[model samples]
Target chain A: MTLLEDILLLGLIVTAVAAPLCKRLMATVIVYMSFGLLMAVLWVLLESPDLAVTEAAVGVGVTTILFFLTLRRIHELKGTKDE
Target chain B: MSKKESAWTRFAAWVNGEHEPAESRLFSMGMGPRKERRPEITLPKREEKQRLHGFLSWYPVASAVIGVILVGILLATVLAMPSFGQVENPTNNEVPAHYLQHTREETGASNAVAGMILNYRGFDTFGESCVLFLAVSCVFILLLRDENNTSQKDLEQAQRREQRRKRRQDVILQEAARLLSPFILLFGAYMLLGGHHSPGGGFSGGAVLGGALILYASAFGQDAIRRFFNEKVYNTVRVIGLMLYAVLFGYYIFTGANGLENHIPLDYGGLILPIDIAVGLVVACTMYGFYAMFTRGEL
Candidate 1:
């Protein structure tokens, strides 16, 4: 791979590591979103635009929203427990 | 100066300290906390576990050793891989070459991936569709609210939500969605229909459509969505899509393979379009269904 591709892969790896290391779950979700975006770019670089499109649309868009919604529900559960 | 430019100029000047923020002008705010911070609720007595399990556990060291060994094995496997894009590699063998060579003539799709998913390896794609459907079904079974089980607590929660609903900023979002929804829907349709010729298909296009519905519901409220797409409608659409794939494929198995009885003089691409649409519908429903079920237990 070229230097650019190597850098992209490195960034992808860093994001994957950083996501689980994040204390706040929401921060982890944001890191995961960037990871998805990076993977999509890698797919494009590999010349599979179809997989890139699916990764961007489904992995980033739908999955992120679902995670956010689940996070909200978790907070609600915690609130109920406190009350 | 142009109106938009002047607006930006004023914003820049304010940020540059030409003007104080509006809140500062309105009220004198303090730098310190206004109230004592409440202690957050934490897991009760995790320190007890340290005593029970011992302070200096050997698990971490053992895990690290195992992890290193596993990583070494993984690295060895990676090093064993043939160099990228090498023609002599096993991956660049006959089967893929045949697929690439005759995809146009046999499958009639310009996009090889699309043809592969919809035509050649269609059963695997069907299984994936079933998996998504299964995910939705599992979500429904676990999280769906029972109509008859209305408690006093739920009633109170509903009332509290009603009070909160008044403060929701819907007008601006509604206006924006009105401007964008049509284009988003059109793009989704393009992705679905042009999938055969290009770099899109059922899953991606369905996600786009589902995302649009999510935006619309968020802007216009659940009741607005319920006016048309209720629980029954939602269930019916997805089930129909799943059933269509199952039934058609089963029929094709008996009628298609057997030459003794020929039904449709076969265009190889005949079932691909319908199957693609079926997968698209199921996927779109799964996406939207997950959002709806998770956010509000009611459909």
Candidate 2:
């Protein structure tokens, strides 16, 4: 593979590792969203703008917000103070 | 010669000194230095034998029947060889461009799909909205059991208990949520109203709005939001909206006058009917209903 492809693969791997390790739920969500955004850019690079738009809006935007909301609800139920 | 032979024998004995006698040849061959002997294979006998026999006899009978049936089906399918080549693709005769042009001119909706759904096939949309309303009502009833008697103070105490157990910092999240929720609501409304000309539609737009409310509740508290948009009022809005949509659809079906037929007399270009307004209301109410059911922890 080219240097650029190798670099992107490395970045993706780092993000994947970091997302799970992040202690805060919101930070984890943001990391996951960044992964999605990067994936959308990859889709755009592959010449499918429609899929890119859908991934950006539905995958990153709406889904991330949903995750954040769910996390908040869980925290509220458990009555645990944020670190 | 006898002395020389005795000396050679003594030398051989010394070379093999302190070595233990090897076991039987068969045992030695099977159980070598680092190797385990093969386990003995014995035929089952007596009571143990009967159990094996019982399992073997019954299992084969059941397996044989299933195997035979599956084989028969496979053979029949192979022999019948149903042809898929004879299947015909259905075609619509209406020219898409012409239909689109006519719909745009008649309804003045920039989007053809919206025009078709809201104006031409409005009955179907009404039914769909009614179904949504019914689902929301069912969810609301299930969640808000003993609705009239449950005092606000009781709900507040419950919320406080849940909050304490969770140990969440409500103030900080609440502040952030207060800042962000308005923008989310605005975006959702934009998607709902601009749906006639854009990619966003009722379902997605309603979800966005519902998501915004859920965010608000999570950040601040359900009690504060509930005070503004009460369960009964939301339910009423949902019912009224569905009824309005049904009435408009029935009007078109009975009177032959189109309900959302955009008659642009003046500068407004396309005039929206009570139908679109009803749809927006239903969407908003049903979304809120879902949020209430979800946040209230009933399911």
Q: In model 2, which residue pairs have backbone atoms overlapping below 3 Å?
A: A78-B166, A79-B165, A79-B166, A79-B167, A80-B166, A80-B167, A81-B167
Please tell me which predicted candidate would have the highest DockQ against the true structure. 1
- Show model 1 residue runs off by greater than 4 Å: A76-83, B1-64, B170-176, B257-269
- Summarize candidate 1's per-residue lDDT along B97-185 as a digit string, tens digits: 98888776666677788878876777788899999999999998787777545678876786677556657767888899989978988
Query: Deviation in angstroms for B150 in model 1?
Result: 3.2
Name the DockQ score for candidate 2.
Answer: 0.09
Q: What is the overall TM-score of model 1 with all chains considered together?
A: 0.77
Check candidate 1 and list the clashing pairs: none
Which whole-number lDDT from 0 to 100 does residue B89 have in model 1?
89
Q: What's the residue-level lDDT of A82 in candidate 1?
A: 18
Evaluate all candidate structures by whole-model CA lDDT and list the values in order: 0.80, 0.66
What's the count of clashing pairs in each model shown? 0, 7
